[model samples]
Target chain A: MKRIESLTNQWVKETKKLHKKKYRDITNQYILEGEHSVQEALENNGLIDCVITTDDGLLKYKSILSKVSEEQLVVVTDGILKQLSELPTPQEIIAIMKKSEELTGFGEKILVLDHVQDPGNVGTMIRTADAAGFDQVILSEGCVDVYQSKVQRALQGSQFHVSIVTNVALDKWIEQAKMRHILTVATALDDTAMSFKELQLTESIAIIMGNEGQGVSSDVLLHVDKKVYIPMKGQAESLNVAVAAGIVMFHF
Target chain B: MKRIESLTNQWVKETKKLHKKKYRDITNQYILEGEHSVQEALENNGLIDCVITTDDGLLKYKSILSKVSEEQLVVVTDGILKQLSELPTPQEIIAIMKKSEELTGFGEKILVLDHVQDPGNVGTMIRTADAAGFDQVILSEGCVDVYQSKVQRALQGSQFHVSIVTNVALDKWIEQAKMRHILTVATALDDTAMSFKELQLTESIAIIMGNEGQGVSSDVLLHVDKKVYIPMKGQAESLNVAVAAGIVMFHF
Candidate 1:
């Protein structure tokens, strides 16, 4: 275990830079803060590079530390942690974790979010995919950077619990997914799409949810085998895309 | 349409007061802005007292305004609109809309949120319920104020599209609901309750979703006829509560 006391410390500066998507991608690492998120990363045995904490960080995460290998622990001052965090109320603990590699052929379910710009929705979808027993959660390049602090917080450490990969070529990813016999069910309001309940999710499937405003891109739709709707019974034009995604994922 | 130009205008001062819950409640009026939200509100022939907008707002929403009564339109200066707005980047238009009455019905589905305080979730849930064709969306007293700007924005005028009532007494509402022969489903992690898919929601039903952290209160649970859960298939323990509700609402 090592200790960092200054915000100017090389590691602290590097950690702060990790907030940028280009930096995260280049380094193959991202920052996730919060006692729960840090603990989940360790407990799930996700790739954890180091742990950062204020004075109280260790106190709050003593249990998590025991679960993680001792060599991975890095303690830093509260000031250092604050400089490295994006949250208004900084968590006592933060973890440097490896970006998840592309995962395939996990199980019966997967999720593909096409250009979901809201980090809150992106993170919530990933978390839902994990809970619904989906094998993986895939993201198109246009979606918010999943490594952003807000997305990580919204995930509540589910980022470590699920298989997630981002910024890939959508058509290539779909091609890889199709090899595993994964059916892609996209959501659209058009008359051609069957109601969600009518779709058979019994086979390995990837449920595609699109942006809040602009819907599924035509390319993604072309890759999908079928289109579905949640069957709106009211005057409102649409459901929040994330909520709609959760509905389909749970049903599948 | 009368125009208000000064930030210090009496109407601007009064409208600014709406940022507080007391003023919003006492007046039974709240602020709504952004082209999309206002258009959604107007296109639906909502209970809007009047609209405040600049020339740009008029241009962006002219199509929607065509559906609104001319008597309810109020043109205002950009300065006045900024003073009335709470968002950093103020939309060109803001509307002072009258709140609807508490809903009482049994023939259609409904959603009751118990003490869920996050404005975004509360708003998203209301909007989601509206899209799902629920008869109404009820907010318990302790939940976030439905008329707040953040909730209003997140709702994206689903507030206008759906029947939303706040400050409700749970027992009475449930009693009125059950009298209509509606199923009341409370979601919990417990296994005995039917998996969300297994439950039938074809008839009148009241599905109660709880707070972000604490689930349906035992008090609310006592009133529900059945408990339901979105089955967990992976390492994650639970999905975000709102996402969970969205999934179940459609599946049922």
Candidate 2:
């Protein structure tokens, strides 16, 4: 196996750059840290560029490491690994993976996020969508990058199970979905909005959840067939964005 | 108003100690940062020991400050306020509040947590319970401290909306709740567990959520009247704890 001992090694320097969104976008690659995430990426046939680990990590994850090709494995010192990691303690293993191809088609159930900012909220919503059997997740232009480490940690490997499409024009997508006879619903509290419980389950549907503070954007709300609200019985003005998405997603 | 200009001032040093759980416990006081949280505590008649802010903060929150008595107000320099804040960018105002008294009576609906360790998860679940009109929340002994800054931020003032009981013994509480004729349901996937959808709504109910890694503790699970599971139709193994709590809370 190849080995890198120096923290200043050219390869180590380049790998560390993957921590930033700009670098990830430029290289079309991101890092997945920890044993579970690395194992999931490997099992899912994620396009892995390489795997980096220490000697201890190699022995600890021997069963998982057996799947990696010798050419794609690199041994590194603990110090080097920590320098490349986003975590404070750093994990035993980290995998460099290429971004998955954009999904072209939509399934029976779809989740659309418009300007949703929190990484944890975005990741949790994606995982919930997967559990709810949603086909695709569409992210509007202003949504947080799903490739960030925080979001990746929150996803817990659901990113591999569901299709995600980013940088979407929500209004255009809604119009296209409507033309295909798919019901598009936005969670909002406008005059025409009705309770989400009143919504009927449809064979093909898309549910749009908005930013944390704001409900669905006005322009996107104008394009959907229905605007629904989750009726809150207590003094809390609204539910957390991720929680609201889960309640709505599981209902159908 | 009293003025504190030095970060090392006796009062400033003492107030800063509230950031630690041990100190918070000793003094029975906690700090609430940011304008929204401080405002919520004030409006809800939270037991305020003092309101600490900079001259700029005082000017910015003039309307809100009008409610605070001169005796309970203190003006501090920007550096002093920063020293007391948890956030990197400290908000203008901070409030020192006494924890609410332990609730003696049970309500119609309750949410019980067993060893839920994540601060964000606990706070979000409490907020969700409030939004669902659940009457109270009981926290197991091993759960994260709700008074922690991270949990307080995630709560967004829901701590003031619902009655919260902390450091609870799950088995004992379950026995007491059962005696009161409340149906206790636990989220788990054991042999006796059934789909949550099959649960019949009762006049009074207590839903127990477990740790992020382990579902409800086996001891607590044995004590509940029913074991329910949220059925997942997709490839994801489980839902995020907070999201799962929201779905179940809203279901009834």
Candidate 3:
């Protein structure tokens, strides 16, 4: 196993760059911190490039570390781990993972995100989609990066359980979905939109959720098979995007 | 209108202390930042103690500002506003509000949070309860403080729309609720639990959600009229607590 003690070491500097989106995009790799995430990655064939841990972590997480190949394990000081982590109180272990290939084919149940920007919301929606048995999740170009640490943390290993497709044009995706006889529904509150409860369960479907402030984009809405709104019986203007997405995803 | 430019002004320091939970608890007041929240507080009779804004904010929110009486408006410099705010890019306007009295009587529908520690989750669940048309939200002692800046931000002014009671003891609350002929349900996955979809719609009910890592407390779970779980069809072990709460809240 390799040992890294200095923050300025070549490998340490390179791994730290994964914290930035530009670096992650360029390298096609991201970092997952904490014992739970590292363990999840190790168990789930998560394309792990390396596992970094402190001596204390190595001992504390012996069972989980046994799964890591000697070549993929790196020992570091607590200071080094702290320097590599974005969290204020750094976890004992971290994993470097390659971004998984996006599955190309449409599935029976799909979730499309249109410009949903909050990291927690994006991550939570992906987790909810997984829990609701959605086949895949597609993110438009404007959504938060799913590989970002906060998003990864919130995902809690659902990233491995669900197929996530990012940077797709929703309009084109909707058209293709409709061509395949997949019902495409976007959440909106326009005059023509029906209550979500009225939506019929379909064999193949794509449910599109929108930005925190804006509903689905007008361009995307125009291409969808239907638009539905979650009826609000109280004085609240709207539900959180992730919450709304969960309600819709679980309904079907 | 009053103008203050000093960062260390006694009032500025005192108001800034509201960022701490102890100070807020002692003062029975909390701070809300940004235009939408302040506007909602103004329109909803939120017991506004005062509104603080920058000169530019006074001009920018003229329509909303008109609702604030001259005696309740105080103008401060950007630096002073920043000093009092927890946000990195502090909004121009802020409102100090007295905590609303906890409603003593139970209502037709309610949401209860038990030891749910994330501020965002706590706030979003409250918002969902409001959107779901639930009567009130009760937070157990261990939940994150709803008056914290992060929680307030996530609430999106739904705090004004929903009645929220904090520092509740769930077991006792459940007992009292049962006595009042209110059905109490909790999310769990033990042998005795049934699918949440099977939950019969009731005239009066309280739905209890638990911590992020743990389901409802065992003691509290013992007191509920029914134990229910959201049946997961996918491989994911669990759903985000807020998302789970949303799905259950809207189901009724």
Candidate 4:
């Protein structure tokens, strides 16, 4: 077994750099923390660059270690693990998994996000979309980077289960979706917008959710096939974007 | 107008103390910040002890100041304002408002939370409950204090518009709700938990949401009339608590 006790080890330096988005983008891999998320990735055949664990972590996650290649495992000192960790209390196990390549195909159901800036919201939406059985989640250029740590935490390993592609042109995708007979729905509150319940079900569909404060962006709103609003019965002006997406995603 | 320049001044000290739950409970008041939340409290006739603003804030919110009593307004230095503020960038205006007294009567639609500890989730749930036009939100003792700053921000001023009562015994409340013929639904994924869609609609309902990591507590689960789970077609283990709450709340 190889043991790394120094923080200045070449692998340690490289793994620490993975905390930043720039480094993550360049390496095409991101640091995944926590036992559950790491285990999910391993089980789902996610690309694993390597696994890092403390001495105690090796024993604690012995079952996890049994599944991975011994050559790919690196045992580190507790101090070294703390330096590589992002959480206040570092989990015993951490994994570096390659970012999944952007998917070209689409399923019957799709979700498009327009400039939704919050990391937690972006992750929750992906998790929700996956639960609702959406085929893919396409992010517009203005959306937050999905590789952000808060996003990965909020996703709770759902990122491995779902197809999440970033930097897509939403207007162009809406046109493509329409051509494929997928009903594109934008959540808006305009007078012409029908209640979400009033919309007729379709075999193929796409839903567009917008920023926290702003509804769907104007240009993207124009390309959608229909506009629907979740009828608000109380004084709240709008629902949280992720919740709104779940309600709409499940409604169909 | 009375002006406070020193952080040690009686009002400044008291306002700063409001950030902690201990002082907030003893004084029966909590700090409300930003234009939206303060304005919501003003419009809804929330119990406002005093309004604190910087000179620029007073000028900017002149329309808001006109509605309150002159005696209740206090002008403070920007430096002092920053000390009293919780955000990275402090809002110009702040208000000290009394917490709403607990409600004795039950409403048609009630949302009960059992040990949902995340402040953001608790706040978002309250906002969603308001949007769904639920009559009230009852928080179990184990839940995070709703007056926490993060919860307040996530709520987006919905706190003033909704009836939110804390420290309630949920098991007892479920019994009362059942007597009123309000359908009691617990969100669980157990074998006996039917699909949320299978439940019959009722005139009134109370839905209990649980902690993020753990679903509804076992003891509380036994008191609910029915248990329903949101059907998941994809691989994600569970939906976010707030998203799950919105789906169940809107399903009715």
lDDT top scorer:
2
Q: What tens digits encode model 3's per-residue C-alpha lDDT throughout A104-164?
A: 8898899999999999889889989999999799999899999999999989899998889
Candidate 2 chain A: worst 10 consecutive residues by lDDT? A100-109
Clashing pairs in 4: none
Q: What is the DockQ score of candidate 2, to 2 decimals?
A: 0.90
TM-scores of the candidates in the order shown: 0.91, 0.98, 0.98, 0.97
Worst 10 residues of 3 chain A by lDDT: A169-178
TM-score of 3: 0.98
Tell me the docking grade of candidate 3.
Answer: high
Candidate 1 — which residues are off by over 4 angstroms?
A68-71, A104-108, B66-72, B104-107, B179-181, B200-202
Using Cα atoms, each model's DockQ against the true complex is 0.76, 0.90, 0.87, 0.91
Question: For this target, which candidate reaches the highest DockQ against the unseen true structure?
Answer: 4
Put down candidate 4 lDDT per residue, A1-252, tens digits, no spaces.
578998889988988888898998898989888888888989988888889898898889999988889888989998889988888898989887888888877768888899999999999999999999987898998899888777888888888888888998888888888898889999998987999999898888888999888879999887888999999899999899999999999987
Residue pairs clashing in model 2 are: none
C-alpha positional error of residue B137 in candidate 2 after TM-score superposition, expressed in Å: 0.4
lDDT of 4 by residue, B185-234 (tens): 89998998999999898888889999998989998888889999999999
Residues B36-137 of candidate 3: C-alpha lDDT, one tens digit per residue: 899899889999999999999988989999999999999999999898888999889899999999887787899999999999889899989999999789
Error in Å for residue A26 of model 4 = 1.5
Q: Rank the candidates by DockQ, best first.
A: 4, 2, 3, 1
